[model samples]
Target: MDVEDDNSYETSTLQVLELKTGDSLRDAIGLLYEKNVFGAPIADVIDSATTSGNFLDPYIGFIDFATMVLWSLEIGELAKSFLWDPFFPVHLNDTLFHVLLLLSKHRIQFVPVIEQFSSKVIAFVTQNAVIQLLLQSSGLEWFDSIADKPLSEFRFENDEHAVHLYGDQSIAEAMHILWENRIGAVAVVRRETERLIGCVTRSDLHLLLDNDDIFNNRKSLTVEKFIHLEASKVHSDPTIEGDLGALLSAGILTLKNKFLPRMDSPVTNRRTDTLKQTMKNLAETNCSSSFIVDELQRLKGVVTLRDMIVQFAPPCMDSRINGGGFFDSALEQTGCHIEKGTLVSDH
Candidate 1:
């Protein structure tokens, strides 16, 4: 079904690694770690790598999370073989239900949108962006009404503006770009076409700040050395403790001791689970997001805290009144138990 002249794009593993397929993922991570990579997951890697040296003793409470970055899958492999295609990407200009349908069917976080003429990826639509759109569409502070109108009413329309850095730019240069722009994320662009090559997030810069890596001296550091010394790490797995408060408290403590910022970790749910089971996970984690992946471990779709708010709020059932960021307040007003490990309840 691919149009040879479509000029859109065919997935290329080589393009992904920024090199040939024969190269290892480890090598790719190492290379980029020396330069840049972004997004939430990669943030975890940069954190671990930069602080590995100082935070060595766990028992002494000097542990660091960035030290645990791990290259589970090779960059080349990830590029050539994604769960979904990048060329035929999800359009950001779509309805909520439609977005939901795509997420459910494709099981992806980001879908690359290619320009029809160039077939080059022009932009990306991610789950986070969609959630923001959903929240905006509701207009109600609480977004309690699940079945409202189509989501396109809240489609994204904005001038292109992004902080950017080049592929071979020094980490110090990346840091300067962020500081000057007063932004946390920067697009790593191809110098010639100004196309997005990758990203360098606040988390990536955090590594530089936390490590006190002097830009002047970094010249002696090779890409391999930087990645091996600062970028290699493994992702953290959230444990299911019977007590929600205990779990959160423990997680917070781990973050503090490890000098890693806390983030919403992934969670799983039984599709057939009771409403009670669903609420329990939501309360304990406060993230309001549960990724619905499949048996193959591919992304299904996402459920937000706001989605549940609409289902339970009484005001939402009555009429379409704007709640104005009142989902948390409404939850409390209704006497829903938000505290960790509390039984599900609605006043």
Candidate 2:
């Protein structure tokens, strides 16, 4: 692959996924609502998607209702259909161009990848994955230049496995699965035939987090039941404009009704040594972040150089002008006196 040095490239070592970069998370959210991916208005999705009986912090938890949403308009309907095959799935062995084709067709960000023979879901080929793969493939000789170590010793690879949930499950039920597994996404399956309904992501939950109504509303509902109510219905009728209106009116809809790019393209990084090797992987693939998966193709977590900086370095050295207890200073600049950290709420 020819390495082009565009503005998106960082030090000839990394590339940022710029497709969605200039776009604001807020605007993307509004587009999702307008398009009806959540099956209701922003407020309704928030209300419908929240859990009722939980109190992580009482006051603090309530504010979770204001969390930012992350629904991508790029991944939509066909993405949802792929979600319905309990076993049939999009896989990772495909290519970047192929993945782009899937997204072009459906507008989904996360697509489930399955094993060929057993027809079992194994891994997810996220948009981020394709970009990272692109970046990783850019640096092929990093490992070959190193002595004796197998490339597999350091690089991350997809095991091609999946974590699943029933299509009839409630939002709260999905929440529990996500929380317990420390994962940000889940796959939904139907009740009778165990067909795939669709997949959900942390972005979806974040969108729901903005609604306060869900807390009081779901007190009596199970998560499985709640999600099932939203994801169970699938519409074969085609038309983004009309479908958007319906979903915006309700709380859930099928993935096929939305826009999702790329389905089952897998690209690989032939192993490399050192953190730079990782950076090379990211740059070649044009991904902002990449996952670290185990041999079983299950996700371990993600590793991004951005994350690396936040982890190892102190706040001041990172060139973040808003660093160095800046929020405290801004509050002080407002001339507010604090007797403790508590401010007197305005009556």
Candidate 3:
């Protein structure tokens, strides 16, 4: 899709998902899950058609799971406090190549496409959405070059160590790590063996918030308890239980209950796993990240959506992109690099 082309990625302003300032937290959660979108632009007015005019703040900044999760920790309602991030905005006149550069090279998660002066948001180009485009390019010369290579072939920026926790760690502790690092999820392992058992994500945090007692007593609960509390929902609630078996098991999870992600194993990939393999597992399981492990499944490193998207990114012509060094002569084959697009500076 050419970003400069008016017809590409076009949708009426009416079709845009906009959360208002006055919506209840519960209502906001229900809408995000119901719409199945990563996030939505926020309008200051109750049913405002126009959002974030000439400024991306309070609109795209008030995004999905991360925005809401961070917001919940602060107060009873959404405020301007949690709206800051590294996201950059691209105008409709920007090239698709430009969007790709930000998604891949800059490792930016969301690039809002908006009108030039008004800053009226058109839509978001995200890493997940872009990666899906790359997947569809299977068998293409450029995509296959990297797709077929093992994950070990690429050097990740912080492949050094993945943030993780033992099952016994308090839920409050887990939330602290996620909030401070601004990461979505962390690997959960067994205390004695350090073997991967499950994970807790920002998305999962909402579950605890759903229950008044759970939310208030989070400091007292272990991560294991939090995960089990989530698993228990599958057993008791039929509404949210479609294909959740991949998320939790029907069998007991621990000495207390039966679950090890799926009563058998956690979702993971090996160093030898291909990029394509990990992408498939992520899409199939609806998981945000893949825990890399040894044959014994001891947690090693984590492959996040950001890591996966960067792998398929084309080499940038602009020397200014943070990681200027790209793979091989792939740069010659790819062109139309820009120094930078119109970015929304985080306030």
Candidate 4:
């Protein structure tokens, strides 16, 4: 494939959800939920002397919904809480190679693209978007070989140390577990059977933020309860608001409504499944990770996008480095520590 210089590329016109410095964490999260986004760029409201038009100061950093959840749990306040420092941003003129390096290094879903001088965010790039680009590019067949390998070979130490949550646990407790472990999602299993019941993700926590009743009563609510409540909303008939109202009024809405069917039946693969098959499943569903299970459907570990991408770094670097000088210089500009084409180490 022919490589193009960074200057020839244009910033994406996708409207980014920019957050102000004073935006409450709850409000920020609600916006994320409304938009179904993982994060947003944070800009400070500022004044410029040269122009009459208002301009936002350089973005401080990016705030992730997951980070917001952690902060809320930490301070025991959501509506009044605010995010502190955000993650680093990439320049708008940076090549795709540079953005990939930053994403891998930071283990984030997306990176904010800022103007070189003004540091103002112009757009953002996402891991899924980059992955799609690679899928359409030449030499994608290279993944065919890598995908044939067993997941066990790619499993890392942290994957072996999988953190879990019991269905009976409180939502507050579940949030703490996810925050403490710094993971995007956790497996929820039955207390007695240890059977995988459902999964709770950082995005799922947004349900609490969207509803005041649930958030205020979180202490008395179980993780299962939260999951079931969200699931009901997802499956409920929008035209029949009266049914939902009656259920809520009667206090009969319970876990029996079923967990969010999507989360309830987690996307999974066997430990022995080929990487190619796993990747295909993940891509088809647009999910970030899948539960690696044993023959009996018992959870063995988790396979995430970061893990798969890290495994592909060696080959990706070789492709880019050999593509020509333009690609080589772009990779070098990323300032990512590298040895023999592979990433130095996981972030």
Which tens-of-lDDT digit does each residue in 1-347 have in candidate 4? 21123222233355666788778787887777666665777776665665474443457767777678778777768855454545667665456666656655556765666666765666555554454444444345555555567777665435565578888998888788888887878888778877777788776766676688878887778877666664444543323432232222111111122222356766788777876667655544445677877776677788876666555443345434332222333455665444576765334
Q: Report the alpha-carbon TM-score of model 4 versus the true structure.
A: 0.70
What lDDT is obtained when candidate 4 is compared to the true structure?
0.60
* Runs in model 2 lying further than 4 Å from the true structure: 1-6, 9-161, 210-347
Most TM-score-accurate candidate: 4
The C-alpha TM-scores of every prediction are 0.30, 0.28, 0.68, 0.70
User: Which regions of candidate 1 are displaced past 4 Å?
Assistant: 1-23, 39-88, 91-98, 139-143, 147-347
- Residue 124, model 1: Cα distance from true site in angstroms: 1.7
Against the unseen true structure, what C-alpha lDDT does each candidate score? Answer: 0.36, 0.35, 0.60, 0.60
lDDT of 2 by residue, 164-185 (tens): 5665555655666655564444
In Å, residue 296's CA in model 4 sits off its true spot by: 1.4
Cα deviation of 254 in candidate 3 (Å)? 30
Clashes of 2: 73
Writing each residue's lDDT as its tens digit, candidate 3 over 207-315 gives: 5645878778878888876676654533333223323432221111111222223312346899899888787666444445778898987888888767877654555
Question: How much does each candidate deviate from the true structure in C-alpha RMSD?
Answer: 21.9, 20.3, 8.7, 9.9
Candidate 1 per-residue lDDT, tens place, 178-254, comes to 55553434445446654344444344333443465643445444322333333333333323322333233223212
Which window of 10 residues has the lowest lDDT sum in candidate 2? 57-66
